[model samples]
Target chain A: MSAPESILKAENLVKKYREFTLDHVSLNIPKGYIIGLIGPNGAGKSTTIKILMNIVKPNSGDVKIFGLDYKKHEKEIKNRIGYVGEVQYFYENKSVTWTGKFVSQYYKKWDENRFTALLNDFQISRTKKVRELSKGMRVKLAMAIALSHDAELIILDEPTSGLDPVVRREVLDILMDVTRDENKSVIISSHITEDITRIADYITFMINGKIHLTIEKDDLLSNWKKIHFKKGALNQEISQTLSNVKEGMFGSSGITDNYLKIKDKLSAAIEKEDIKVENVGLDDILISFVKGE
Target chain B: MIGIMKKNITFFIQYIGFLYPLMVLYWFLRKDSFDLPAIMISGFFFYLLISGSVNILESYEFKNNVYHFFKTLPLNAGDIVRAKFYNVLIAVFFLFTANSVIYSIIIPDKNMQVFSYIFILCCMLLTLNIIAVLYIGFFSIGFNKMGKLLWITLILWLVLTILSVEMYLIKLDANLLYAFISRINRMVWVIVTFAGFASYYGLMRIAIRQLEQNYDNV
Candidate 1:
C-alpha cells in the first residue's frame, strides 16, 4: 500500500463538552473506498462529522480534505463535501422541488440529471412537502441531495437508521453506486452491521468518546473468530481460556460465540460432534469492544 | 446569491400580500380612534423589518449541520442573511409607498402633515428594528441561546416606543420640518442603518470562527 488514496482526514481532532471529549481522534478516509465508522449510541460519531463539516467549533485539531487544510480551503472543501446529519430536518413547509431548485443555485457541479434520477430512484415525490415524508423517505431525499452534487466525499450519520429492511437495502445500494467512481468516497456512521459488511472496506470502531480502532475489513474478517462452547465444557476451563466475554449467557441453549478466543477450550470429542465455529461480524467485535468486558 | 435571494423574496411577497391587507383593514375598522392606522402600520413595519434581523432561529439552522444541504452549495451565509433582510425591506418599502400615495390622495392636507411624521416614525421604526436584530443576534450567539434575546427584545422595543412618542408628535407639525432637516440627514440615516447591519455581520463572522475552534478540540 504505497500511500493510500486519501480523500478526507481528521488529525488530532478534539471537541470537548462538560462531560465528554472526542479525545484526539484521527481518521483518514482513502478515496474510492467506503469507510464505516461503526459505534453504539452516544459514541461521538455525529460530533466527528459535525467537526469535519466545520459546523461546530473544535477545541483543537486540524481537518484536511483532499490534502487541503480546512481553514484555508473551507469554501473549496465545502464544494466537494456533502453531509447528511443523524436527524434530517429541512424546511418542513417547502416542497422538494423548491428545496432542490434553491440548492441548485449553490453548487457549480449540480447535475440536474442525477438529482432527478435519484428522486425517481428513491420514489420521493418532488411535490411532497418535507413534513409529509416518512423518516425513511426523508433520509432517502437527503441522500439524493447529497449525491446530486458532484461531491468527492459524502459524510453521513445514521443514514440507514429508522428504515425498514427494504429501505435500508435501497440506501446502501445508492451508497455502493456512489463509491464506484475512484474519485468519490463516503464516511458513513451506522449501527447496521450488514450495511457496513456490504460496502465498507474500511471500518473504524468508536467507543465511548474516543475511537477504539480503524481496521481494514479484510484484516477484521481474517483475524476475528467466534468460538462456540458445548455442554460438559467445564465452566472453570471456559472462564480460564475466554476472559474477554462481553455478553452472553451459558447453559448451552443458544449458539453465541461470546467465548471466542485465540485458543480453543472445547473437548476433542465435542469438536468433532458437528459443532460449529465461524468468523465474527462487526456487530460481535463492536459489542465486545464497546462494552470492554 | 440570486437563487437564495429569489427564494426569500418569493416568501416575503407571499407573506406580505396576505398579512398587510389584513393590517390595513384592521386600521380601517379601528378608524374611530385617531392615528390608529399610522400606529398599526408602524407596528407591522417594525416587526417585519426587525424580523429580518431578529432571525436567531434562521441563524441557528444555518449554523447547525442542518444547512449543509445549502451551505455546501455556492451561496455564502451572509448572502442568505442579506437576501432575507432585503426581502423584508422591499416588502416594507412597497407598503410604505402605497400607503403614502393613498393617504396623499385621500386627505391631501391632513396626510401631508401626517406624512412627514409617519415617514420619520417608520424610519425610526426600521432603524430600531435593525438595531434590535443586531443586538439579539450578537449576544445570543445562535438560536439555541436566544431565550434572553427574545424577552429582552420585546421589553427593549416596548420601552423604546414610549420614548419615541414625543418625536412622533413633533413629526406631525409642519413647523418641525425645519428642526428635522437640521437634526438628521440622509447620510446619517444610511450610516445608522448600516452600522447596525455591519455590527451584526461582524458578529456572525466571530461566531463562525469560534465554532470552528470548538470543533477542532473535539
Candidate 2:
C-alpha cells in the first residue's frame, strides 16, 4: 500500500529573534487530514505557521505547498491556501460586503454566492463595518473568507483562542465540515488539547521551538496509559518506562507511553488486580511533554 | 496590482471630500493676487500639504495593520509598490490639471504663459512626489525610523524648493523667461517627460526590492 500524499511539507525551518528562536521546526500535512499543532504560549507555534505561509521568511528551511517552492510559486501557493492568522487584521472601516468583494478579486475560484451564504450562516451582517463586529464575529468573518476561496489547504493559527464555548464549537464544526471533501486538509495551531483530540486526526506537540512528537490521535491515546500500582509492587525495571510518577498515601500512579510493550509484562499483575490501568487523554500526554517528564 | 491601486484610490477618496474643497477655497480666496510666481508657490504649497496629509493617512493605515492584511493576500512586493506609485501619479495628474483649469479661468490674459509655467512646475512637483512615494515604501524599516527619515527629507525638500522659487522670481526677466520657454524644442519636452517617467519606474523597482527584503518588518 502507498502512503497518503502530503499537501504541505516543511523541513527544518529556523527563525531567529532577539528573545525567541524557532529552532529547526518541521511539519508534514497530509491530504484529507486535520493536523493539530499544539504548544503553549510563546512556544513557536505562531512562528512556524508564519514561516509556512511565507509571511515571515525563515532563516533556514524549505517549504513546499502543492510540491511547489515559495520562492518561485509564492502567489500560486498562497492562492490555494486559506490562512486565518492568530490576530485577525482587516480594513476596519470597510463594510463586510466591500471587504468580501475586495478579497474575491485575488482568487481565481472565489465563489461569491457561497461567500454570501457563509455570511448568512455565520450570522454576519453584510452592511456592518469590520470594527463594529465583535471578536467572535471577526473570527467568523475570517473563516467565511477562508472557506469561500475553494482552497486546497486551510491553515489556522489559534482560531479558537479567546472565544466563547458556543462560538468555538461552531468554528470547530466549520473546520470539520471543510474536511468532508477528501482532497482538502487543515493545519490548526492551538494550546487547547481538548479541541485537538476532538477533531484532529494527527497531533504534533511542540515545546521550546522544537517539535517533540507527531502521532496519530488514536495511536497516542491507545499507547499512553496511566497505571496506578502500590509501591514495590512494580519493580524498578518497569518504573523506568513510566513518567510523571506520583505517590499518594493510598497508592502510586505513573504514565506510560509504551503501554502495549509493557502490557504483557503486567498481565500477571492485571490478572491478580495488583495494578489499575486507565486510558489517558491528549491533555495528559501534552502536559507530560511540556513539564519535561 | 489593480486591486491594490483601487484600494488606494478608495482610501484617498475618503479624504478628498475635505481636502479638495479646501484647496479650491484657498485658490478662490487668493484669485486677485494670482501670477506666475504666486500660482507656482500655491501649487507647491498645496502639493506639500497633500503629501503631508497622505503621509499621515498612510501612517494611520499602517497603525490599523493594513500591511498585515495585505501580506495575507496573494500579492508580491512589486504589486504593492507599483500600486502606490500609480496612486501618486494619478493624484499629481489630477491636482495639476485642476490647478491649471482654475488658473486659466482666473488669469485669462496670461493663460498661455501661466500654462507653460505650470507645466514646468508640475513636472518638478511630480518629481518631488515620486521621491516621497519611494521613501514611504521603506516602511518595513520600522514605522518610527521611516517616519523620522520621511519628515527630515520633506523639510529639506521644502526649504530647497522655496529657496529656488524665491531666487527664480527675484533674478528672472519676463522676456528672458518667455524666450527660454519658446527656445526649448517640443521634442526636448517629450524626452524630459519620458525620462521623468523612466526614473519614477526605476525608483519603484528599488522600493520593491527593499520591501521584499524586509517584508516581515512591514
Candidate 3:
C-alpha cells in the first residue's frame, strides 16, 4: 500500500489477554478524515484504540498522532486529542460544573461555551451529580467533555454502543457538525456499521483480533456490488477466482462475490442464463468479512 | 509539580471533612460530656494520621467502578500515586485543623500543647500516605486486598505506637515523644526514602504499563 497521509497510525501493534491476542495490527487514519474502526465483540477494537490513546501500551508498536510518537509526545498528543469511550468514569460525587472546571484545567483549549451549549442541547443539569444520571446521560456528558476541548482529532471507542436511537442520532448530528471544520478528524468505533457508513471517510473491518480489511467508505459503497445467480450457475472455480465473496443459497438462489472479479465471472454466467446482480450495503460487506468469505 | 501537589492536597482534605465526622459518631457515649465533640474529633484526627493514608488508595476503587478508566486517562502511574498521597494529606490535615480549632475553643487556656502533638501526628501520617500510594498502585491485588492496605497500615502504626508508649510509661520523660520521632530520624529517613520512593514510583509505572499492554477488561 502507498504511504497514506495519515494523522493517526498504529504500526504492528501487539497485545495479549488471557484467551485472545491482538495480533500485529497496522492501521492508518488519514489527515482530515473520519474513520470507523468497526468490529464485533472480542475483535480487539477497543484494545487497539486504547493503545493509540496511550491508555494501554503495546508490547512493541508505534502509535503516532500528528506525526509524533505517542510515548515521546504524550503530553502534547493528549492535550490535543479527545477520547470518548463507551463507558467513562466520572467522579460520582462531583457535579458536572466541578468536573468541567477540573477538565478545563488540564486542557489549554477547553471551550466553556461549547461545553455549556452541548450540555444545554442535551438538557443536562450541571448541578446533578454524575451518579444520579442515567447511562445515556452519562454518555452524553462524556461526549460533551470530549467535544468541548476543541480537539483536532477525537477518538471515540464504541461511542454509540448502548445509547437509544434518538441519543445516537444526536451524537451523529454533532459529529456531522464537527466535520465542517475541515481540519478536524474523528476515529470512531461501533458495531453499528450504518453510523460508520454515514459519517466515515475510511473504514476498517476487524475480526478475531485482526483487521480483515481497511477500505475507503466511499470506495466500499460504490465499488462493492453483490452478484446474485442461480444455485447451479456458479461453481467452486468462480468463487476461488474471486478475492471477496458472500457464498450462500437463499430461496433456491445463490449470492456471491462483491469485488469486480465477480462481475467478470457472472457476466460469463449470465451469457448462459438470466441472473440478477444487486447492490450491497456496508452490513453485507461486514457479514462477508466476519464469515471469511 | 506544585499544581499536582495542590490537587492532591485538596482531595485529602475533603476526604476527612466527611469521613472523620462519621467515625466520631460511631462511638457516641450514652451521656454527653462538657467537651464530647472536642475529644472525639481530636482522637479521630490522630487516628487519621496513620489510618487515613491506608484508605487513600481504596478511595480510587470506591470512587469508580472501573479503574481502567483512570488507566486510559492522560495520567501516568506517578500522577495517580502522587494524587492519592496528596489527596490523603490534604484531607487529614484539614481534619486535624478542625479538631484543633474546636478543641482550643472548647478548652481555652488549656496547656496540653495539642498543636505540637498534631504536627508530630501529621508527619507520621505523611509517611503512611507515601507508602500507601506506592504499594497499592504497584500491585494488582484484588479490591478486597486493596481495601486491607489501610487496615494493615493502621495495625502496623498501632503496634509501633503501643511499643513507644510502653517505653515512655516505664521511663516517663516528656522528651520521649521527641525521642520516638527522632529515632525515626526524618532527615536520614528522607535521604533513604529517595531510593524507596524512586523504586516505588518506578514499580508502579512499570505495573501500570504492563496493565496497559495487556487489554484485560476490568
- Docking quality band of candidate 2, CAPRI definitions: medium
Per-residue CA lDDT of model 1 for A89-165, tens digit only, reads 67777899987887777777889999999999899999999889999998988888888889999998889888899
lDDT of each residue in B125-195, candidate 3, tens digit only: 45544455534543455445556665665566566666654655577564545355455655656665465
Clash count list over all predictions: 18, 0, 8
lDDT of 1 at B71: 48
TM-score of 1: 0.77
Candidate 1 C-alpha lDDT tens digits along B98-184: 566544544334534364445644554454455435533543354555544655655665666555565656564544543554466
| Candidate 1 chain A: 10-residue stretch with minimal lDDT | A251-260
lDDT of 2 by residue, A1-293 (tens): 88999999999999999989998998999998999999888889999998888888899989999999988888898899898988999989889999999889888889999999999999999999999999999999999999998999999999999999999999999999888998989999999888888889999999888999999988888899999986567777777889998878877789999898889888854454768899997788888888983
Off by over 4 Å in 1: A229-276, B21-79, B85-218
lDDT of 2 by residue, B96-149 (tens): 666666766766555345454546455555655455454545554666666666
